[model samples]
Target: MRSFVRVAERGSLSSVAREYGVGQSTITRHVAELEQALGVTLLNRTTRRITLTAEGARYLDDTRTILRLVDEAADGVRSATDRLTGTVRISCTAALGVRHVADILFAFQDRHPGVCVDFRLSDVQIDLVREGVDVAIRLGALSDSSMQRKQIGASRRILVASKEYLDRHGRPDEPGALARHAIIRMSNVSGSDRLVLHRANAEPSILPVGDRLLVDHGLAARRAIMMGRGIAPTHLWLVNDLLEAGIVEQVLPDYSPEPVPLSILFVPGRARVKRVRALIDALHGALRALPGMT
Candidate 1:
């Protein structure tokens, strides 16, 4: 059942075999034997890829639930004689993971020595169930309504550039002046070509800005800003230390980008597991305490 669930999620028998440190033939036999017992085909196989059948798809959901319940039961039994033990898998946005979440995980592991962490970092939104991820630390507005989420904080974004760049290029006195200066943009986000700024008593200013360089990651954009490349609107958490050190200065200080919500999303079944619950509680508190997360 375990092997089948992994094979279903990963879509490859060989990959599951490698993960289990076994031969592909062994995994093939396991699936074949299971199918024989059930008298139903679970997958459609071809030379290049595998696809789950209609029945298989339904079975997959039930199988995952069964596996989760079994693990929960085992953990409940073990808690009587041992310290908390089990792996907690987490997925987080890349920049935040590198800057803060990794440190939080280290501290968590230090406190719960028997617990193991499987951490994954990516800027792209991934399907939690398909990837077998227990929880994801996400930024920006969430679109999925069905998933369980806990809003930890909000990420405030602001326009910023290094002093060296502004010294040579001059500062913009108004939002309209941004068109005359180079801007660094995040390529993956929609509307990277524009800046929307807000102030206390005035209407929001939407300005078109030309990109001098395009980067997909927050850290890359920060490096470009540090190298005096161009001005960028960035999450404060991504560059707070640099700002404090005076390595970068806020542009158009009175105006700011709309703050985006930061949340921890989890699979409903997985959140009930003890280790997963513990990690989520730790992260909710720690991430809320990060600089620029309000």
Candidate 2:
């Protein structure tokens, strides 16, 4: 059943065999035996690839549910007296993973030494189910409505630049003066041309920024700002350490871009697994402890 699930998801018998440290013939025999017992064609095999039959697709769902339930039942009983032991696969944005999330996972592992953490970092959002990720720490808005998620916190974003850059080019006291200075824009964010800033006891400011440098990654933009490239809006967690070290200063202390939400999204029934649940609980608190998160 485990082999079938891997074969269905990966669509390669040899790949599954390699992962399990077994021969291709062994994997083939396992699938053949399962097919013979079930009395159904589970997959269509060709030279190039294997595709699942309709029956196979339905069976895959049931298999996943059964596997999850079995793990939950076993782990639940063992966790009462024994140490929890399993792998918790997690996905997180690259910057946050480096700046904050990685430490959280490390601390979690310290507490549950028997548990293993599989951490993956990517700027691009990945399909949690296809990637076999138990949970994903997402920034900004979430698009998948079908997935179960918990709102962890929000990261405060602010306009910032290096002290040297501010000294070279005069600081903008008002939103209108920004047009005179170079703007470092994140190309990945939607509507990079316009910036909306909010302040207490004042109407929100909507300003159009002319980009002097464009970067997609948070660390890349941080590098640009530190080199005195230009002023850019960035998450406080991304540069909080630098800010404290006097490497960079907030461009406009009074105004800031809207705080981006931090969320933990998990695959259905994954939270029932003891290790995954433990990690999720640890993340909920640790993520909120980040400098800008609230």
Candidate 3:
């Protein structure tokens, strides 16, 4: 049915075959089987093109509606089931995946061995539908309002540097002084060229930042800071361990960037899947347990 729908919509058997990653003969056979089952000619084929017969035109609309309802029914059944069992495709930033999400996934897998997880860790934002991702863990503000979101916790970005770097370069006394210090910039996020600092009951301060080093991954930026390359703004959770161990210290402690919201995003109907719902619940609980997460 999916193949037929694709063929009808695209108006080419070969195109549908490529979309499905199957041979053209397979798509031809699928349509042939459907026609045979229905005992009616659904499409008129010429040497160069295929056109839907009148019967095919009417059937196509009904088929699309049927397919939609079928999917909804399956989702409903999955949502009501007690046992969660299926593959869940998830995407998250590389730093968060390495530092935190991996452990949460392991624990969830341990509890529900029947569930399989396809985890893709990258800094680039992925299209949930196009990428077939069931869930995405996003940090900071969400731009796509189409996806359903559940705020799990909050993450604050703060200026941090290695003790060695601080001792040598000296800490900035205020937001304005940051211009004199070398800055490690995260290339993946927006506003890397500027620092916006906020404090309680005070107007926000903005200062242009110089990029001494730029990295694509948060972990890479953190490494640059720890190597005494420069000071960088980072999520508090990412550097919490290093802070406790006296490896790195927060700079300009009096001011911090506005806290970025941490959220789990999914397609509208995806939350109805049992496996997705289970994972979301597990992740929410895990994130709440982390230090400095609200």
Best by TM-score: 1
Ranking of candidates on lDDT, top first: 1, 2, 3
| Per-residue lDDT of candidate 3, residues 1-294 (tens digit) | 767777776678887787568999999999999999999988888889888899998998788678656655765675665456767889998998999999999999998887989899978888776565779999888899999998887886888999999899888898877777888887767887788889989999988877568889888887887899988888988889999999999998989887788899997776766678889889888987776787
lDDT of 2 by residue, 192-221 (tens): 899899989999999897766888898899
- As a whole number from 0 to 100, the lDDT of residue 248 in candidate 3 is 97
Runs in model 1 deviating more than 4 A are 53-55
TM-score of each: 0.93, 0.92, 0.77
**What C-alpha lDDT, on a 0 to 100 scale, does residue 144 get in candidate 2?**
90
What residue runs in model 3 are displaced by over 4 Å at the alpha carbon?
Answer: 1-82
How high a TM-score does candidate 3 get? 0.77
Candidate 3, 258: how far from true, in Å? 1.5
- Candidate order (TM-score): 1, 2, 3
